[model samples]
Target: MKKLTTALSLVAVMAISTQAATLEERVKALEEQNTVLTEEVLASQSAGFTLVDSEKTFNGMGPAASKVYFSDNPLSIGGYGEMFYANPDNGDDFADVYRFITYFGYKFNDWVVLNAEIEFEHGANADKGGEVVVEFLYLDFLLSNEFSLRAGHVLVPMGLINLRHEPTLFNTVQRPEIERQLIPSTWHENGVLAYGRFDDLGIEYTAGIVNALNVNNSKTTTPKTGWIRSGRLGSSKNASFEPAFVGRVDYTGVNGLIMGASAYYGEGSNLKNDDANDVDGLTTAMFDIHARYENGPLAAYGLYTQTTLDGAEKLSSNAAEKASGYYGNISYDLGGLLGVEYKMPVFAQYENYNPVEKTVDGQNEDAFETETVTIGFNFFPTKQTVIKVDYEMNDVNSQETNTLSVGLGFIF
Candidate 1:
């Protein structure tokens, strides 16, 4: 229980939605919350009951991303979605409706608030074709429990799947490719976020500035320096306000543990050439470290990431200024360690990525070095759904990419 509380029904559904609705009104508000919020599934479903979401957390954040910091009905809503299916041994198979997201919030009293998230991918068609986005929008201010204030379009807390990527709090169904390619999962921008907590040194923090990352798109590779996940500019309208600074710090003082570290610095040529800052001194820096553990029924995690860049050898010549990766995992539940009753978890993961780890003017793509291994299982018949099967082995560069997957994920 990562308890950091606040009242008012303790909103929490699970996040990223509400970019102004209209995907059939966000799938009719998640089919009317399966009959209005009573369908709540994020907390109780028995079996090793661990806090998932929809219980109430603000500093621990959850439920459509903190549900306006626990609003008391000044309006709050939530959403989540996932879908997957694959089969391959070189047979080329596919199935995906990949994502659907929703979230909206508002609270105007106890110190102003508003929130948003809306996404639809590979499944939405009408509003100008699949892949809609808006992943975050913000406004927050509360000056207690250690301070707070957030401003528009954030989500750059760095890692743990970029501010809790929902899906019942992780256990694989894709994610963790060194945090999706050198620390870039669901990376958002457009500035300002600040968080706080200390409470006798239990420690907690998050910092942000946002926007900044262009990484000179050399049309995608060959000196693009693997451009940090293709320089996710997120909202893109010829953006580049040039600002980027991210941060994180966590400790959770033992008991179920969480240890963290994160960092980012930026100036990756978002301005498309405003006098080259004198021929591209582009700029970038990244770092990461993580650990998590959940007691009972056993769970474990680990991560490490790195990136560095500067000018990228004047843009090509094989440009790569470094990149890195790491991953780890462990899971166990077996229905709360076998007293039976349901809920099973079994997992294994390993990763080592390199997206071009060191080059500054050519020669470094030994096929972009990679390795991955995943073994999984998760079954929850209730508790807001989960049924996933996984087996993956990848070794890129030396080729070989086996796959077999099945999935379903949910949160409400």
Candidate 2:
């Protein structure tokens, strides 16, 4: 009886040892699986899907457009969209998808990156006068903190809106007429640029050569609209390619303040299919002085711009010899005053411009003068989205008109 009991005890010990070995193996397998899952989670977090920081911008670009500069992954995607409805006293009431833009960026390495913007306007339907276009596409060679190079289709660094054209960046539903008609806010061309910043000096500068404008593009230049805006060649397939010089400098020495000037000089008569004799020597020059200030809840920004046509008589009988304009905007954040989380800013803007300030035929400039007053408010539902409402009072050549506009804008 003693022997049988001992044998039973040994068997019981052997069974317990086997159970312990199996448990150890299972725990080791689980640890290996956990390690793999943890690695995957970390990778997903850094996969170019990070949130945007509105206050952060790189190389004077908008936050969304600068995503690649701050991205951890090799590929980045960002964009913005805006839609608006307008009711005009002397025109038709309409609602339209004004702009939808997408930014695609890829990092070839630590020093080289590719960035591009594709824009869809007015719903992108040809029958409805909508179209798709590439606003800018460039390769950035980041050489140092104070100097870099960019080549390909690039935005002409001229005014506030031209560099930062996102809807949320502006206070009005429509861009100021001065920026539109005088500086041409969305101006871009194929070129090579050199840009840099001096942190110690608090200065930023950009200088480059871009495709010259074709003053002869009749589709853009008209008697009522002026030839300044028509000079942008953009990225058309058959666009003429004459080199033009452009330069800009800005001072940010003081916190919450930016002051700058930009200039462009080019021969505008460089048409691809035009006769040399008919083109003549049409030289174009443009310049602007701009400033922006933000302190706590109060913000103000404005610019004064002028353009000159040296050989206006050669273009047409009614060609404008010179154009000039100015605009100012100020806003106070009610959200900050009320101590709320979201933002609500009320703004007022005033503009005076004359696209036809001087005509080759010596026409009266008073008949082309325009003035506008706009009052508006923007409500931010989130950091990346906003709702806007505004009323505009316009006087064009002493003819008065009024309009009410509502808009929705978002960025990501």
Candidate 3:
């Protein structure tokens, strides 16, 4: 009986020891879990605080990328560049190109802003004379949502792309001759302008005054007329800073569509001419229409411009004859092929230009006419970078020559 009792006591002690050991293990596990939970809570709180502060600070800056100063108020800087390659069917070779621009903008307040852009062409190489040009320098004053005033060097807003066309913004490798000759793309001079929109009526308008055109750049197709015509029309002369009239009217409510009509009338002067008074004043005018529809990865666009020169008979004997030119282009984009994430934009464009109007003294003068068509594809691996390939066809009216070109271009 004594042996049995001793055995029972030993079993009881073992059972109690096992129970205590299990309790200790559970407490240790619970403590470890609590430590992990505490750490997670601390981390989450820290992140939340950081996000709130960041939001507040961002909001306080008031949509500014740069600071304000006394002379220059709120300023912002942005620009882009492109490189290209070309192989012309006419045997002319163009390879590895570069064009760059930098723009600086200052906003005085909600109503006024100043913008300037400096451009560099052909890689800024000394071999190309390193053409450094000011593309635009202007001040804009917003009087109301429906009306604004602008002045200084201003773009002649005749063609669709003349004012807004940038390498990255355009789908093709080059602009059409029609635009170059008819409306003179990238043309700007000293001028003042007014523009605005009426949201209730869905109408927008732009108008401006600028310097006039010169005889050398006039685009008259006929040759028999004198070269000394009064193509110098628009605003005033260089010495006087003549002002030309330019403006446009637009409609913008058709679901992602922008359609507009534009016009320009101006006069110009010749400072270097010995017989300045004899040179006829240019009576110049242009008319154009453009439209764009874009949504997501798809886009469509078209533009046409026609220009005429009058008052040539009023000029002296040494001037040019009556001259005129017109241009048109159309394009579309097809987004992503092969079910890939990348955006594949394919487009085609046409351009024509007649630079010189009539020759001098019976000599076969330059009746410069150029026509070009381009089909290209742009691959956007990312939002900020584009790789482009294009095939271009050129038909020179004077030379009766044709060329084929292929090139690569990019922007960032």
- In Å, residue 35's CA in model 3 sits off its true spot by 34
> What's the best-to-worst order under TM-score?
2, 3, 1
In terms of lDDT, which candidate is stronger, 1 or 3?
1
lDDT of each: 0.75, 0.88, 0.58
**lDDT: the better of candidates 2 and 3:** 2
- TM-score for each of the candidates: 0.35, 0.87, 0.69
Model 2 Cα shift for residue 147 (angstroms): 1.1
For candidate 2, what is the lDDT? 0.88
TM-score of 1: 0.35
Residue by residue across 344-392, what tens digits does model 2's lDDT show? Answer: 9999999999987887787766777999999999999988899999999
Best prediction by lDDT:
2
- In model 2, where do residues sit more than 4 Å from their true spots? 1-47, 217-222, 276-278
Separately for all candidates shown, the number of backbone clashes (residues 3 or more apart, or on different chains) is 10, 0, 33
Top-TM-score structure, candidate number: 2
Given candidate 2, what's the lDDT at residue 225? Answer: 61
Candidate 3: list runs displaced more than 4 Å.
1-73, 96-98, 216-240, 268-278, 295-298, 313-334, 352-371, 398-412
